[model samples]
Target: MLNVDGKVVVLTGASSGIGEATAKVLANNGAKVVLAARREERLRDLKSNIDKQGGTAVFKVTDVTSHEEVDELASFANDTFGQIDVLINNAGIMPLSFLHEKKIAEWDQMIDVNMKGVLYGIGAVLPYMRIRKQGHIINVSSVTGHIVNKSWAVYSGTKFAVRAITEALRQEEAKNNIRTTIISPGAVVTELANIITNKEIKKGIEESMKISLPAEAIAHSILYAISQPDNTAVNEIIVRPTNQEI
Candidate 1:
């Protein structure tokens, strides 16, 4: 039997892309999924699909940028499922632009969603995991986290921060028996590119995505991380399309 069977997973950013794929994959493997995202309609649709397929899932409309909402999401998941075995900090945004463009709002949004949102998720789940001395926290970073590129300064900064934070959490919580994993994915064809305000960059990204991996590729990486045994920790995974050089 898969280790993911019977685990209660709280997944954020689950309205689309990697989050959505991960939620379905885990649910199909017998996980009790708690989907979190800002779009209630999408969440409901996802839950309905999962239910139709004989997978257990529920959803909470949540904005990860707000600590209060994240807290409530954690509470709701625990209240509904009895405990949260896994928390996937998957809410993030990438509004790529040159620093010279000075798109401060986009930068702020990225920080709030990518960096602080992950922090809030960690904060919300730590107490419960610590008390149980057992849990898994999977954070979604990016290829930009390891290799910075043009127009990716702010987005890369947030992703780098994710790796840093996940590493620290791993070190700090080893005694608590909590597992931490950071998934850094390369270009996958997803809605993330739609957020780019820079038309030129967006065009280039779309062009480059001609050979990108599917969101399910990254979702399977997450499933692999979650399927590890209690004594093993698959700490980090960087998955890119075979054609992606960077």
Candidate 2:
């Protein structure tokens, strides 16, 4: 609908969940997708499926936490596709825990993957996008960014940082003809909850996930943002299940 045909999209965390679904949706709509994730096998499998469906795709194994690796991902996308029209920073982890629990390692992990990862993605592609004079950067946030819940202090902080970063990027890059978007999604069925070590928190997340939307819902939102005309910059999209109160 937005005429995304022939656009080149680079997506991180593309092995599963929102990243995987977004890859399929964009590719099906005629966008050339470059998938990046830590899991090489999954990336390969996803690329194969996209190709089987008559979509163009290639994959590069990457960890978004590493600035160098993220830079390489951008380079690989440019090398393979000639130019990148969009960069989707979708790789993130959600290991919700109470501060009193003293899960320092988990907190550090969240900061590294969620906050620093998004920054690294932007750093990696910003130069390229600036050079191109037309590109889009999509960062995935969460509803927790808007409202801090009981056990989501650190997680929410990370997502909130994403929103701030994307907004700043939008303001700064507008002159360069680059668009930025922050996608904040509520609970959805994904492997993000599996990383929660706190049993009580995991149980609560499981219950909430029972009524969640599929990953494709967020994928569709990403597609809509990317499909918009060059003059239209869809800055932020908040998508939640109809029954989700939060």
Q: Return the top candidate by TM-score.
A: 1
What is the C-alpha lDDT profile of model 1 across 100-122, one tens digit per residue? 99998998999999999999999
Q: Which 10-residue span in candidate 2 carries the lowest summed lDDT?
A: 1-10
RMSD to native, candidate 2: 0.8
Report the C-alpha displacement of residue 73, candidate 2, in angstroms: 0.6
Query: Candidate 1, TM-score vs. the true structure?
Result: 0.99
Q: After superposition, how far is residue 158 of candidate 2 from its true place, in Å?
A: 0.2
Worst 10 residues of 1 by lDDT: 189-198
